[model samples]
Target: MTKVQFRTAEERDRAQWADKFTAVAEGNLYRDKNSPFPIHEYFKLGLLGKEVRMLELNAGAALVDHMVADALTELNISSETEGNADEIKDWHKSIFYQDTLEQTARSFFSCGYAAQQVVRDIDPDTNENTYTIITLNSKTWYPTVPTFKYQEIREGRVVSIFSENNDGVKSWYAFVERHTKGNVEHELYKLENGNDLEGTKLKIKDLDRFKELEDSVATDLNHIPIFQIDMTRGAGKYFGQSIFAKIWGNLQEISEIKTQMRMERIKHFRSLLAAPAQSLQRAQRVDDGEALPNNSKQARVEQYEHQATFDLRQEIMAVPPGAQMPQFIQRDLEIITKAMEMIRDCLSEIASVTGCPRSVFNLDEKGTIHVETEKKKDRKYVQRITQCQKKLEWITEQGAKTYFQWKGDKAGKKEITAELDSAFEMTLEEKVDLYRKMNSDGKFISQEEAVRNLFPDMTEEERTEMLQKIQDEDKSLAGSFGDPVPVEL
Candidate 1:
């Protein structure tokens, strides 16, 4: 493969973007030196523990990651396909729902962004078709160009993608290069040597070039094909802001409240475990007119030590005259409870910013959940999920189309695209009601559609059987009870 060299404006723009991408990524991840996350400081101050938490003592960063990512997992995506389209649709189900993809998304959601490339593949032995969706760590992905709106990556918005890879011994670099030659063409680049790729001859390789990339001295692109999935885009910057930006202020408040609560608890427990000692002054009658020791300090110390030595466990102690036991006050449990309320309040504010409900973080102050309030919170949460699902739909479409095309059935693209819907789902009850209302005025309702809503978890065969039984029962009841036969009566 030959390397193409160009000094065009587009190439320079890509180079310039590489510099800015690193800064943007670091800032988003809170890894930049000037960033305000204070993660290290939190650890140093004992706000965040060094040990991994089996039970989360602090709901700071971990809580955010879990709430956002798990919300995304709630999305139900499926394609409505007919005939040959079923093959593409099945491939779509198989690829996108992989555990590895979900894991990648969660990791990215933690830091505000993620990337995955769909590469087409053809089996060698039977010439069967296959595809791979390779997930990339957002930190390693450097875009060739910057985009203002992340909803869609229009043509020319992203010129290329630069990603760094490591194999333990040395670091390797990969680039998904795009250039216009009548139309946009994508070429993958890697280093001739694994050591460094500061300036080297680039090899034009296929998408699978990532696997054998680390060892080869000559730049080579594996034969994997790239098409529409070549566009590098993922869940954009956290709601279009820095991942930690929304929670930064509230996070510190939570930490301070937690630290104060911990300190108060420790003091309270110590007071309970150990009681205060009584101070005593020995009023020994100095011998009247007797010669006392010249060492007045030594004599007083000996007398005081005698009074201090006592068995407190016996509940009685010998003491000099005028001695008194110290009175103790128990720590107020109300103060601790009030502080917990403050922590909950801070979490509630954070939840408002994250589009996560207080209940998700277990920050319920009312003790009981209100169903209507929870439903309202879910609507807000689903709004965010809908935005992400829209992006994933485009990515999935490319994967499905690539699969069908490689299988020598390019016509399946329309079938796959037409039926693809990754939109948010309504409850079965809602769907059933909707269809029933639409058909209330003697309109025909597809039994398959109605049955899907009624018995969503049932298999196709089971649904079919259930629908048949309902139809048979309806016919029998109509015949048996139809307007009492007039002639027979």
Candidate 2:
């Protein structure tokens, strides 16, 4: 790789490669439903696998990885002008080539699985031309390299690198050289010696290693080989066959069988997976009325209490000398000093506010105030009457003495007229007759005053005649408040 420029075009190529390769691996490996190859990588990237967090490798996946590496190399070269390009490469060399990043990376390695194929023409039973390549992928969410593998820079070389897990525990893995021919059978055995070395051993078989390769590939795993990738690829003219990324969740019913899992397996999975823990004690506080607990908890917590202090003691000459209080006691002291202080300040302020000299009984929290005013509360008699319905049997001359009471000298001839000529439809003659009924006892002085105010002075005969005329007019004006009813003796 040479110095290259960082470009969007390069990024697109890299992402596309990751997608295409994953799809190719899935389509090829998952030809049949029962195939053990999990299309995890394919599902994740190209959307070709049926299970979650799984990978199915194929020509496409291999190609995607290969091309992505190629692209990265191109990018680093292009970005030569970037800050410390050569310097960065030098640092990487010091780590990777010098076995610095190996320890941590190895802990997360998990294992390495390989499948070998003969690249030459040969007899099915006895062929002697073959080569083996180990494939590597990550189980962690770490995104350093897409994948890695051990390969000999020369022919006739078999290299196996072994190391214990990060915890420095577990039985040493037994890696033995495998040989194979078609229907090849390799011994599933272990290495007697647990050892460590600066390098590894490599076995190169030119004549044939068929049986060995086949047996090794079928180790532990019941299903065919499937490698998961990041994503899928779209259609291109001279590119890969139209590979569809399988959505893993869609075929979840099938994958469920592979995992042998049910909803019960995730009984509290959704809730547990969605959130973090909280602490109950964090909501508590101290005697100062302050809130306690400043954190969250995943479980319940027990609570406690703190009490106030109070005590009473006296110098008892009759008691024994050795028996005594903690010596920190302040006997007969006011336990509620803060409250008492507050009350004292309030009283002092009130004393200055009112010229009453002392305010020992001011309106404090413990005291009461009965405010008295000199003036009486006035009363109003105006009442609203709704639209008149039937009769409102008010005092009439006949029923006057029965219901009405006089609050003055001898009662005057009172007229109780119906609110007429509007809502209830009354005529002036009815009103005059009604008034006369309420004043049956002549009451000349009062009738004279009524007739004068509403009508005007007139002789007894004239008054009768005028009153009749006005009543007739009120009948015409019945819809209006009847022409002011004429008063009479």
Model 1, position 165: C-alpha lDDT score: 50
Q: Model 1, 285-382: lDDT tens per residue? A: 44435554776987787666656554434544444466554444557677788987787777777677766667666655463333433433455555
Candidate 2 lDDT over 326-378, as tens digits, reads 22322232324443454444444433332112212223333434243212111
Off by over 4 Å in 2: 1-3, 6-20, 23-236, 246-489
lDDT of 2: 0.28
User: For each predicted model, how many residue pairs clash, with residues at least 3 apart or on different chains?
Assistant: 1, 60
Global lDDT of each candidate: 0.48, 0.28
TM-score of each: 0.50, 0.14
Candidate 1 positional error at 143, Å? 2.3
